[model samples]
Target: MDPTNSSTSLAFEVAVFNPSIIVGPVVLGALVDTCLFGCLVIQTYVYYANFANDHRAIRFTVAAVFATQIAHVMCVSATLWNTAVSAYDDPSKLQMLPLASAATILFTGITGALVESYFAFRLWNVSKKLLLPILSMVLCVIAQVVSLVITVQAFKTTSVAEFEVDQNTPITLALTSRVLCDLILTLSTAWYLKNQRSGYLRTTNMIDRLVLWTIETGLITRYDERRRSWRV
Candidate 1:
C-alpha cells in the first residue's frame, strides 16, 4: 500500500466518524457533571453541619450518596480525559466505548435509585399512602436494572455504533421509567402537601414553597430525561 494513500484513507474515515459529534457532547457533559458535583458537595456539607441530630439512618444514607457521587465524578472525568486527550488523534479509540464511560452509567443509576428511594420514603412518611411510593420504588428498580444491562452490553460491545444498536430498547425503557418515577413522586408529594395546608398563613406558605420546589425539580429531571431520549 502506498503510505500516502493509506494515511489519506484513515483521515477520511475519521472525518466520517466525526469525532466532534462524540467529543463535544462528552466534554459538555463532563463540565455540567463537575458543576453539579460541586453543588452536591456544598449540599452535603450543609446537611452534616445543620442536621447533625438527624436520625442515624438518614445520616448514613447521606454519607453513602455523597461517596457514590464522588465515584461518579471520577468516572466521568476519566471518560472525558480518555475521549478528549488520550484518544485525540485515534479515531478507532474514539469509536470504542471506554470502560469508565460504561462505569458511569452504573454509578449514575445507583446514585439516582438511592436518591429516589429516599424521596419515596419521605413521601410515604408524609402522606401515609403506600401506592405511589411503592410504584416509585418499582420504577427505580426497573431503571437501575436497565442501566446495569446497558453497562454490561457496553462492556461487551466493540464500538459506539454497535452498543447503540443493541441497547436502544433498554435505553428507552430506562429513560421512560425514570421520567415516570419523577413524575409520580413530584405530583404525589405536591398533592399531599397541598392537602395538609392548615390555612395558617405561615404554615401554608411553607407548604406552598415545598410544592413549588417539588414540581420544579420534577420538571427539570423529566426534561433532562426527554433530552437524553432525543439524543439517543
Candidate 2:
C-alpha cells in the first residue's frame, strides 16, 4: 500500500474505534453496580443469618430482592461483554441494542419497585395510614409499567440512537415516578416517626436518627435516578 493511503486508513480506523461516548459510561456503571451488588450480598447474608426470626413475608421480600439483584448484575455483565468483548472489532455492533440491555432495564425496574413497595408496606404497618402506602404503590406500578414499555421498545429498536429517541418519554416518566415514590415514602415515614415522639430523651434521639436514615436512603436513590434521567 502507498504510505499516504495507509496513514489515511489508519486514522480512519482510529476514529472509528472511539467508544468513549457510548461504552465508557456503561463500563463505569457496571463497575459501580458490581460494587453495590457486593454490598447487597453482605447485607442479605446478615439479614438471613441474624434476622431469621423475622416475619415470613418480610423474609420472602428480602429473598426476592436479592434474586432480582443477581439477575440485574448478570444482565449488566452480559451487556458489558457483548459491547466490550464480542463487538470489539465491529464498532457498528455497539450501535445496536443487545438482548441483555433490555433484560437489564426490566430487572432494574423490578428491583426498584420491589424495594419501594416493601418500604411502603412497612410505612403503612407503622403509621396505620392507607393513603401514603396506596400512593406509593401506585407510583411504583406506573414506574414498572413504563419500564416494561421501554424494554419492549428496546427490543424493536435497530440502533441505540433510535432507542433513545423513541423511548425518551417513557424513560422520563419512569424516572420521575420512581423519584416521586421515594420522596413520598421517605417523607411520610419521617413525618409519622416524628409524631411518635415520647417523653424520654433517648426515644426522641432515636426518632431523629431514624428520620435521618430515611432521608439519606431516599435521597441517594432519588439522586441516582435523577442523574440517570439527565444522562438519558
Question: Highest TM-score: which candidate?
Answer: 1
Measured against the true structure, the TM-scores of the candidates, in listed sequence, are 0.78, 0.77
Q: After superposition, how far is residue 96 of candidate 2 from its true place, in Å?
A: 0.5
Candidate 1 residue lDDT tens string, 106-200: 88898889889999999999899899999999999999999999989987876775576678899999999999999999999988887776546
Considering only N, C-alpha and C atoms within 3 Å, which residue pairs clash in candidate 2?
Answer: none
lDDT of 1 at 76: 95
RMSD of each: 18.8, 19.3
What is the per-residue lDDT of model 2 for residues 173-215, given as tens digits with 9 covering 90 to 100? 9999999999999999988877765435678798999999999
**lDDT score, residue 56, model 1?**
97
Angstrom error of the Cα, residue 33, model 2: value is: 0.3
Report the backbone clash tally of model 1.
0
Displacement of the residue 152 alpha carbon in candidate 2, Å = 1.3
